[model samples]
Target: MGGFGPLETAGPVLVWTVVLTFVFLECALIIGLFLPGDSMLITAGVVLASQVSGEVHVWALSVGTMIAAIAGNQVGYVIGQRTGHHLVARKNGKYINTRNLTRVAELLHRHGFMAVLVARWIPWVRTLCPAVAGAAGMDHRKYTIASSIGAIIWAPVLLLIGYYAGSFLENVSWLMPAVIGTLIVGLVLGTIVGVRQYRAEMARPAEDFDLDEAEQEPVADSPWRRA
Candidate 1:
């Protein structure tokens, strides 16, 4: 019932709103690093499976969330383009601090399109990769293709998992309690891990990003951006 609970009574519109909003925020422009993107997708499916007539069917949910995720990443890419590479220097943010940004940069540098495509499977990396790729001057077309593929793979799998599993577990007495308990445990563990990582990351001074290379060639001129 964290956010999706009360929506049961409110009907599918509000539920769609919540799901799509989070789908966008986590995968796209909002940089909601701490959001439970994976769990949410899975749970959304699972919940729909058990519901009598509420929430969108799994296929629709999958497609809608995929669109939201792709759109979100595209927006994030534009934000990165506008913000440029200096976004890596941003610090003191709750989650968008320098450390996380730098990590995204390194990952992008190491893998290029591969990173953007697969980042969908990783939580924090997925949140920041589009922006990082944009800031780093990855080609918009390639980023779009990669991000779209990522969204396609990411959304439906999780939603379907919850949907089909929920359908099967619908008759079980322990489903609700088990799910609630699992969510609670996951939340606590995620909090603890996030806090520890935050402290450690913040402890280090911000690293100087390579500004000279970026300034040497603008987006239009850079072959990397055209790739």
Candidate 2:
């Protein structure tokens, strides 16, 4: 049965470092949208379970990865809070465009907490959701709570699955390769779609996304006016 290649040869220290780093980066940075963080995690577990003396402590790995993921989400949230205003003010900035930002704002308004929690399973969205939540003025405390819960669930499930199921997977040599191939295809497609969306969004008028002003227009006269 094949394993994680050189990662299997590497000691537990290197394995832990690599897996944790990718997990954090995937949760914190936009570049993580393309990184194989999820796959790396499960593969780490699979390699450890292969009984080749990987010696990695499962508890440490799970807890550390969970903390890393939560920390990463916080970092992303802060980044969004810091830069979201600038992005909104500008029409066609370099990285994030206003059109997409508008859509995220609407989404957060609709499903702030649930979106954050569920985003953990959604790869690219997992990387972007924290930032969008912050940018949309979602409650910081609520975002933290939701993201923490998501981390608790997301960080361990796949890794544990791979660890426990490694024996069954060992007999199915084609599965790992197929999963890897599918992830590669997804990365390419996501990159392509993101680029195309950014370009199209940049072409739209920024003023159209002034959602705050539109909402502030008062649905009805104030109570004081009734007198």
Candidate 3:
């Protein structure tokens, strides 16, 4: 708690709220494009490691963060399943662009479960992948299995890194600033890369959009499409 004096004294409830809300919303909604979930998780880990507050348990934080991430993705998937195509149809002034949705759909078709697993580490993709999987009519079982694996791997690894760093730097006041600075720089860079990828995806031609199997053959399978 050397240089993290104030953080050590900070209330656990506030910390929990900040961490959980950011992680949850970042996964559950398109707002994740702008939010820095990685940074938040790492910061939470550091704070907990610094023992800034005894009330914050590393296990609890890790588990809670994982749950929030998984739950958020589930919500996003459901939203995509229910209203994805409608949103695409009305994509005139919506935040969810049809082009990007189509691009995501294509990725899902190409990579299947792998897309969900890998996207968990890629900022904007992580938020959009689940929705795309749903909209593409990917098997729910496959999506859930892949998403759960990704969440389990992603949350704990970062949190542990921060926890270890915090423990190592607990006595070194000067090193804390360097760690904090590095995290800030990483967050900025990640956001820039994520935004660029998103823009690139949105710029893809409409012709490249992937239609569902039923959509590809509408009249022949109208009942199947509705089902």
Clash number by candidate, in order = 6, 0, 1
Q: Which pairs clash in model 1?
A: 28-72, 28-73, 45-162, 45-163, 46-162, 46-163
Write model 1 residue lDDT over 89-195, tens digit each, in one string: 43466556666666677666666678787788888888888777777777788778888988998888887877777666666756664773576467457646755
Q: Estimate each model's TM-score.
A: 0.74, 0.68, 0.73
Cα misplacement distance, residue 30 of candidate 2 (Å): 1.3
Top TM-score: which candidate number? 1
lDDT of 3 by residue, 29-122 (tens): 7767666788877876776765654324767887888899899989988987875454342234233555556666656666667878888998
* lDDT (Cα, tens digit) per residue for candidate 2, span 1-227: 45555544665677588778878888887667656777677766766665455335655788889999999999988977765433342357433455555555555566667767888997857876777666545678888998999999997887787676665666777775555445445645655665566556456565433435312222222111110
The TM-score measured for candidate 1 stands at 0.74
Candidate 3, residue 215: the lDDT equals: 37
**Global lDDT of each model?**
0.69, 0.66, 0.69
lDDT, residue 16, model 1: 65
Stretches off by above 4 angstroms in model 1 are 1-8, 54-56, 88-97, 177-223
- Number of the candidate with higher lDDT, 2 or 3: 3
TM-score of 2: 0.68
